[model samples]
Target chain A: MNILLRHRIILPVVSLAVLLAATFYMQPRAMSYFGLNLLFNLAVPIALATIAQMMIIMVNDIDLSLGTFVSLAACVTATFLNDAPILGLAILLALILSYALLGAMIHAFELPAIVVTLGMSFVWGGLALFILPLPGGVSPGWLRALMTVKPPFAPMAVVAPIIIAAVTHLLIVRSGIGTVLRGVGGNARSVQRAGWPVIWLKALAYGLAGLFGVLAGMALVGLTTSADANIALRYTLLSIAGVILGGGEFTGGKVSPAGAVIGALTLTLAASFLSFMRLSPDWQIGAQGAILILVLTARLIFSRKGAGT
Target chain B: MTNSMMLFSAAGLALIAGLAEADTSGKRIALSNNYAGNSWRQAMLETFESTGKQAVADGVVAAADAYTTSENQATEQAAQIQNMILQGYDAIILNAASPTALNGAVKEACDAGVTVVSFDGIVTEPCAWRIAVDFAAMGREEVDYLATRLPDGGNLLEIRGLAGVFVDDEISKGIHEGVAEHSQFDIVGSVHGDWAQDVAQKAVAGILPSLPDIVGVVTQGGDGYGTAQAFRAADRPTPLIVLGNRQDELKWWAEQRDANGYETLSLSIAPGVASLAFWVAQQVLDGEDVAKELTVPFLKITQDTLDEALATTPEGSVANVTYSLEDAQQVIASAR
Candidate 1:
């Protein structure tokens, strides 16, 4: 591989570095343990959710129900898990099973992934509304404690994202099963010709997505210490954007867990940075969108240059 | 135009009140709610239902019906209102989706001689009677309270409600207006909390690092306890957090005061105002003179009142004081 091709991650990495530098330059205290904790505390759940979306994207499928499913898990965590531990555990497991079943059903009917997930979003959202019905529930004490755990020297919020990325990268990039999953997404016919059950691979990918989505939901509850059925609805679009921003390709099999994590962090920080800069709430959404588009456009130019060579 | 319509309704009401033999038995009242996503809205719906049933028992109204449009859409709510009108309901108690989007439908209802009582997110139709707490006043009052606490002027983190929302805009403007009155208090930063506990907490957490020493926080409803929790979690000295009237927030503030001498004022639009709206509709149906616009006071929960409010408030409920039929009468009198 050429030098330019070898440094494929340089664009996203450089963009992330620049953003970090700018944020720290403006608010130097953000480099401190406490400051870092305050800044990145909410990113853990977002990173996990992005990874969930990334996994589905790896299989060339989009999970529109991802955010609602996370909300469902959070509702369960805040209500059933806090009040009735055993029942909550059962429901959470059942939720993951349902995701796997959804994947199998989609494959069986050769349905458009978008339609199926879109339809299921309501199903999951309805179930969430049924369970909690209100934006009020207490997360368990232990979970709350877990979210607020302060380590010496560096903040857990800062470290957890790196560890999450590394572990996901190890599982999906280095391991043999990872190859099968990506292969199924990239070229299902080729994978099937090699005696791999493409159907099972698709289901496993969805199952992994569900697992990560559950983690995201629990992490979110931990941070806020409460649950609402509609709290994380905005995450569906954000997670998708994170995946795309992180160098994840839609044609399938090309995704970087580290890039996805960085993408999520970048998006989270963009909003926080806008708030810090004292921009009006009306401009925050538009400003964040502009930043995402700008960064991605720069990355695209870099990729084009590399391809041209 | 709405003023003239209001005057017309007021005259009609006065005429009805003057007639000693006016009958209101077997009148139907319908509740049209937009969304049921929060505990406060659920509480509002519950109060509306209960108050309606009590009215039924007293033979003041024949039946009370409620329809909640799961989505927060003006078109959907307007459709429901039209349906209520077609059903020949005498009154429609509405928590509207938009301020002006329901005006046409409300006018239709008014034209059909249906008493339209709107509250919370109210309609702009002058023909419809509105009952709500003064939101801008709540914001200004919160800042006034904070100013007294911080006489020397200090940095304040403003946790505004949902972005682009009329309530958020009004209350935020009021906060700024109050802050303008006292130039010492500086708003270090501001962010939209979407009026949800978790969202407010997370948004606060994100911006805390960039902010200086925040002496106090002013917030809207559904956000107070979570803001307090965020401070507690960060291991920072809890500041003068002005609260919205959520029962959990009251409970938390009480616990804090008991444990550590923490003190703060709480204020919010009471969910029971729904019941007040109900009583007003019923009174209007009973041929009693009622004002077209009723501005109910928000619940002001202080250290002295916190205990009583929390004691009566059920778990998972907002801190509220229910208004009685007598209280409704007083409100009507005051409005007049």
Candidate 2:
């Protein structure tokens, strides 16, 4: 909120500007159709997940179960609510409450997020499997229609993710907990010395990560019009990619929300570029793996260069 | 490491022969693919390039070239088209990105005297003939099986692949049309599995507790395992008449479930897409007058015929046998 804080957000803002500009330039035609469903629902959940990772990284922790949480939340939602609109609401609330409790447990005990979240993800995956033996549930056609029908300028998928990210970022920066998160990132030892509830802040961080998982799940469930446990698994790596791509670090340091957004868009663009090249599906996989590596290397190089200066 | 792994490992061995063909023969072929994220893509590529190599070895074509990429980007695939132009490939097979982005590249390929073939996936653009499978028709084929039996009517649960992918939409579209005339069947649930076993399993599990009177489940790919697991877990007898890809276990499960009083409507089809690709490749290469679109053989192997096919075939081959280069050449000649 302060002028100084705004200045700090500048680098990520600029990075996002560059990414959006490139996005416009690369797909001049898609510039107007800017809000496709894949972008909104499918893409946004991952973006928010990335932001959630950013918050955790700012505090020098990592949440490995973010993807698991999303997948599990989605699986539960579709299975329980496939027939009714209330299923969606019920699943969403259940996911948030369960994750919040888990986050509290993790932070209250001062457990390592890498360990805590990873274990939690496995638990969720197991739970999903136990619940759904086969992938054969019909979505309440209403939610599918709502998610698919793009609102005027762009599809709900694209806009919804952006809105979620914006709201999440506001909470991260403007709220009291947001300050503690930053403060914890700066010097958790000092924050603890200053008598802040360091444990609760970390717990809330995981809760935020859970929120990202559910949102991404919702979008994915909407995007694919079905939910799968493995879908979220891929984003685990991508979420990390998005976070690091956004210039965020996990070991309790600075994280730029804007950089995370730009990182996601850039990755999207890279994938699109591969499509334009008309490579084989086999080649596409290799190329995406290659490009993901390239982007990560680029991010690392830039981060190192920035650190050196 | 993966490159060497690809070379040293058998995972890409069938495709590697395709790379060798580029050098042995003078002509080059480039494959512009839309998305490589799914198993359907992998199985397709394995069958495609292997067949491409077989053709080149038999002197059916001058040379062969290949490229692979992901579905996330369209421009990069378009760029690959240009790359094919620079490389001077004799032909290009497009699985396509968005069906429209490749139009410019396809025209360029044709202009350069390079034949273009679209397979499995239709480019939606006007190009050389499309060697595509009739997904809509196939949907009817599967649905018809269920319809003729369920004259008295029953509940049907349809499981689809990726919502946006061509496979899911076209197949489901066919199902919608096929069941239109049939009055007895009601679609209970449609879950998106993206063609993964774990997903299929999870989806079936969610609905089992609620739907006690569910009749038949229509699925794509080898999803029988997922379905069976869900049924086993729920302490429900496996439905005898489930529709699925020809996995080995489906045969045993069907017999066992039937004995246990569950009517399973299951089929393990292999010669489905692989045969289509083989036929398409032959038709395109030999300049055959085959229909722009053709439907390959889809086996409806039930308990009666599962053993014979399994004995001669590999554990999970789509077809009883894969065609050699000579067979492909014949298919091509027959089309002409």
Candidate 3:
């Protein structure tokens, strides 16, 4: 009970409640029809991107390429998915593998993730453009439907990611891998000297990030029903906002699934709130910018307290 | 006596050559079109450069200066106009970024005896002739076309271009006016799509699942491209009619419907920018007395016309759409 209270679960729960309360303010017509749909649209991609970002943060590294990772996943999947049901799974697998390899290359050089991912991001985005020079490319119908078509508020889009988040929580907290990853993120050289395969640990981190990036790519394909270069650019910054405010470090050493979930909800709510206020869409960009600044400020204050304490 | 005759011959020859040169020089012309920094604007520039070269070959004018920017910085455009006036160009053609903003510059050019004809985007101050595609008519056409298809009148969603823009506001006004006559066609509301496909798609994805009976959709920009993806995935005949841009993708959709022998009615108002480009150039050259506001009427192409045009198009390409400035002058003249 003490752990539960101290762990900041209340912050997330309360934020989710605030989001729900804001929902009451929407037009009844829009509330009934589009509110959950909008949430679902943001959920899958944001969650996957957040998780991918968290993996990098755990190790004190950052994959600024997450948005690009998503685009590459879509470019690969869309170019090859071929409307076959089996092709969908193949595309998903190929995307994760491709990013994993990209991660491995970066890992081999012991390079700062921001620098590596930045270059990789451009390469991946270029691949996306090359694959779909125009907007009318075909996305597999089954995945697109599962991702987009809503059945009330209980859309697969919203539910599937929540379930994945739950499964991830059980794996990380209940398993031995979670403890080692935490220790490694806090100090990699120490973990390495202590005989933990540090490269594999970071490799696992990159692979996990890539896996989630592909998931976001697939989810985005469903939501928009068309994949393009711009989708990646939109989420590039938001994923960082999710992780930083969730209080995750740059290298994946210590992070919480619950906090990440809350971070996603918080970002989504903030956007919905501004949009609901009928503020010009321009304000949406400004509001997001402000949120990032506030989150960074809080992180600084919290870090100072931790040091002083 | 022999030295005097030789000197006279040299002076006479010089005088005759000067007369011949003056007769052949035609007139000097300059263009200062406001730029919107869009592909459509780029297409206009390409046409302008090509047309100017062609006109020069035809001796339309001595030369045409092409000045472009992302926004028609009225100050910069005014400076260019001043330069043209100083250089003594016969006239200037313009596309103003803002009607109210360009007042001082436009007035300056007019005072300098520089003939000014505006096209694409126009100014209210009325320096000279305003050449444009009938934006209001395009809006009415979309609403009327959609209502005709869905007589029982279902929920309608309007996706407009840049908010508060002449195209956006006038089309919206025209749509409301058109729908006012019908009991069935009710417009839900309008949202700015910014003439971008991604924006329109995201809006549609959010709006579509909620409104189960969206009988009609109105759009400005490549929104129809995004809308088609959603409808195709749902595997339905977008039973809802579309008021969409005449882009390659939308043209393909129209062709698909025609191939299956279904009547696809899409009302696309091809930009009057092309005709306006030519007309403004000619007017500036010919020194024609033109009006301050010239509204060019758009051709209301239906399935019949589209099918006929498609058959004639180069394989896999939509046929080029051409609009005549005279046709616009006639329509706007009649409307007034």
Candidate 4:
């Protein structure tokens, strides 16, 4: 049990497995391939958003604008990307560069990340609203096809998250640059003393977060086939919750990429499970709260037990 | 005619129509609602459940299930719609999160031969049947009503709905058009209330100190009560505020009317339009020649009908009227 708790990924994995089993038990039809596709399709963008949030959290910063940033990206994708692909790609690239700049400014000025990102949330939301005020923009055909593609042996919903988890794990958990990046969060002064560029590392982390946020928005638009300014606003809270559920902490550089992906899937399946339970609408939201509390309590208990010995 | 008489006649017609053809007995229908945080939406869900239960008891549909996304996100709603399709529901009655964001999932359902009927928060997909309110007209009419009360049209405060929503833009456009036509009324200040009473109250309170004396407040429903509260809190004279058909708004209007004869207009989309969407989905599943688009008339309350509306509307709910099959057919025929 101590070993399992030490692994950190086991908690999220067990939570996801339990939720999946419950969902299938309630609605046996959900065990089929198409059923899994329908159940987990929306989890793709959510997983992406979670990874983006994890990136920021790993750097010991929280991004309050992740939701609006993703919304802005979706708006840009649906409008500019559909009409003029070159312009859209350029704008998206510019957004990532802006994120890097934001990180640099924060580090250079010693600005609070929460306050800065909160202010940027409004900026991104306003920009998204300006671009697609009426929520009517078509997604590009290729993006839609890619999102909805039915790869054999597993649905895109299942396949995409595994790929995201594996790739991010390789990049953030198994690389030399990743060590430097994590080092910045672990002990910035020590890392700077070690001759690593702390500001550049922070900028890289923010840039990667921006990239994942953009991908999340694009994947969302691809699935929805259109864009709206407020389309992915709930992603802010969901992504934060995903990171915490995946054993990522707020103050430390402790994070697990695979666990975060599993955490996203768990959150998605929890909703599905609740729906299949046919709880009344009044209790449905409350039941979701209860599920979150239950899982977090279990996590807390396990962690405490591991610490005591 | 009295409201009950009209309902009785509509039900009678529906009974006759039901005897004539009942091809939807085996169909299963689902309601994919995005949000239900407000009294209006709660009323809508309740109305749908009650009406759907009646239909099932009468063997109109085999099953009528309703699912609402916990988070009011288009992505969540799209997933809910797809799950409904996979669950083998023959039809889906949707209160969509966005006008266009659910089109992909909606199109997939259409391809699977599922009948989709969206109401109130309607979708823009061509394959789905839309039961929409003429919200712009509702907004225009608010100004027109105020025009009658204040002929010399003074400064008007515009309380809009959520920003960036299609409904908000349409209604605001209509209000602006009305202001253009009237030429006497000027909208001096505008604020987005997000169609919530508390939000409206806060926004109005924040802006009232800066504005000059306001004679009338033009609102997009759900904000009138809050605007009134803000006026009271600020010790300013209450303007002639048009109201949404929320029960609290109506009750407040009644109290003001009784105390000082404060006369005003109340108008909003009935929450029971979900029932209308349900019937439309059933009709489409029954292979009826239903049009892809239909308009639902917004419910309006005047000084004369205020008492009646207040009496019928439950406490903390909205004024509602569940549509019968005959009414659905009438709407379809009108569209044709």
Q: Worst ten-residue run, lDDT, model 2 chain A?
A: A33-42
DockQ in order: 0.01, 0.06, 0.01, 0.49
Candidate 3, B163-216: lDDT as tens digits:
755678887787777788666876775566676667776766666665656667
Candidate 4: where are CA atoms >4 Å away?
A1-6, A303-309, B1-22, B136-268, B298-311, B315-318
lDDT of 2 by residue, B1-336 (tens): 467763554433344335433443555555666565544555566666676677667765665555665434433455456445545566677765534434444555566566677765555545565655666777777678777666676777777887777678988898888778676778877787676678888988887787857666777756666777787898885553455645555555545745764444444334324434443544444444455543444445555655565465445544234555434433443344
Q: Using lDDT, rank the candidates from best to worst.
A: 4, 1, 3, 2
Error of 4 at B236 (Å): 20
Q: Candidate 3 docking: what grade?
A: incorrect
- Quote the positional error of residue A133 for candidate 4 in Å: 2.1
What is residue A297's positional error in candidate 1, in angstroms? 1.1
Q: What TM-score would every model get versus the actual structure?
A: 0.51, 0.53, 0.48, 0.80
Per prediction, the TM-score for chain B is: 0.82, 0.70, 0.75, 0.82
- Model 2, range A1-309, lDDT digits (tens) per residue? 354345445554555556556544654444544323222234555676677667667777777877767677666656676766586677677777677676677667867668977887888888776666434344446655666564776656456656655775677666677778878877888889989877777666766766666766665554344454544665676677777766566656566676676566656555555554554455666786786666557656655776577
Give candidate 4's error at residue B141 in angstroms. 8.4
- Predicted structure with the largest lDDT when compared to the true one: 4
Segments in model 1 whose C-alpha atoms lie over 4 Å from true places = A1-6, B1-336
User: Could you tell me the lDDT of residue B150 within candidate 1?
Assistant: 84
Positional deviation of residue B113's Cα in model 2 after best superposition, in angstroms: 29
Rank list by TM-score: 4, 2, 1, 3
Model 4: per-residue Cα lDDT over B1-336, one tens digit each: 689976886685566566534678888999999998877788899999999999999888899988988778887788788778777889999999999999989998998788999988889999999998887898899889988999998999999999977789999999999999899999999998998899999999999999999999999888889999999999999999999998899999999999999999998889889998988888888777888989997788999999999999998778988888877888886687
